[model samples]
Target: MWTIMMILLISLLIALFEVPYLRKNAMKREMLVFFILLVVATGLGIAESLEANIPNPLDWITFVYKPFSDFILGTVE
Candidate 1:
């Protein structure tokens, strides 16, 4: 889809501008972090394009906390 293309194109543009700078400065770790973040962003973009059911981290956090919160409220009441 156009969304994927745009995402990739923008990412490519960023690499085009940034990667060489990282290489010029011998920033190996920075380069690795950049690529890792780029790949993660791209994968999330593609998954979103396909409407994959990506689980929300907040939902898990809330699920894990809810019982404890209820217990506290029960004791407080």
Candidate 2:
């Protein structure tokens, strides 16, 4: 719970520090992208803190390539 709170607090601090520059410079697109990335990062951080089972990207790659690797080994043999 404290880890989740810390992640949110850090994200909030980042936004507080950055939002004004974006607003002052009229960077609407950048602001939109920033918020989107911040939300994604914060959600992932919270999920990790909660010990949620997030799938690794490499797992998917290994799954996809396992058959190809097996075929290559068979051909080499």
Candidate 3:
């Protein structure tokens, strides 16, 4: 899809512009972390563009706590 292509192109452009500087500076660990974050962010962007319902931490928290909240409210009432 065009969105995916655009994402990849942007990522590639960023790497092209940043990687040599990292390499020249010997920032191996920083580069590794940067690439990992970039891949994750790009994947999430693509998934969102595809209308995927990505589960968030808030969803898990609500699922775990909603029942407890209801029970406490019922007892108080």
Candidate 4:
């Protein structure tokens, strides 16, 4: 789809501009992190374009902490 193509093209453009500087400076770790973040962003963008129901990160945070919170509140009561 057009949205997917646009997402890829934008990511490619960002890499084109950034990758050479990273390579030229021998920044291996930064380059790796950059690629990882870029891939994650691109995948998220494509998923959004396709109208996928991406779960909010906060939901995971709340799920993880809810039990602890409940226990703490019970102790306080």
lDDT top scorer: 4
Better of 3 and 4 by TM-score: 4
Q: Write the per-residue lDDT of candidate 3 for residues 1-77, one digit (tens) a residue.
A: 99989988998899899899888885679999989998998899899889899989898999999999999999999
lDDT for every model? 0.91, 0.96, 0.91, 0.97
Write down the TM-score of every candidate.
Answer: 0.79, 0.78, 0.69, 0.85
Better of 1 and 4 by lDDT: 4
CA RMSD of each candidate after superposition: 1.8, 2.0, 2.9, 1.4
Model 1, 1-77: lDDT tens per residue? 89889989988998899988889996688889989999998899889998999999999999999999999999999
Q: Arrange candidates, best lDDT first.
A: 4, 2, 1, 3
State how far residue 70 of model 1 sits from its true place (Å). 1.5
lDDT-best of 3 and 4: 4
- Weakest ten-residue segment in model 1 by summed lDDT: 19-28
> Arrange candidates by TM-score, highest first: which order?
4, 1, 2, 3
Off by over 4 Å in 3: 57-77
Candidate 1 local lDDT, residue 17: 93
Best by TM-score: 4
State the displacement of the C-alpha of residue 38, model 3, in Å, after optimal TM-score superposition: 1.1
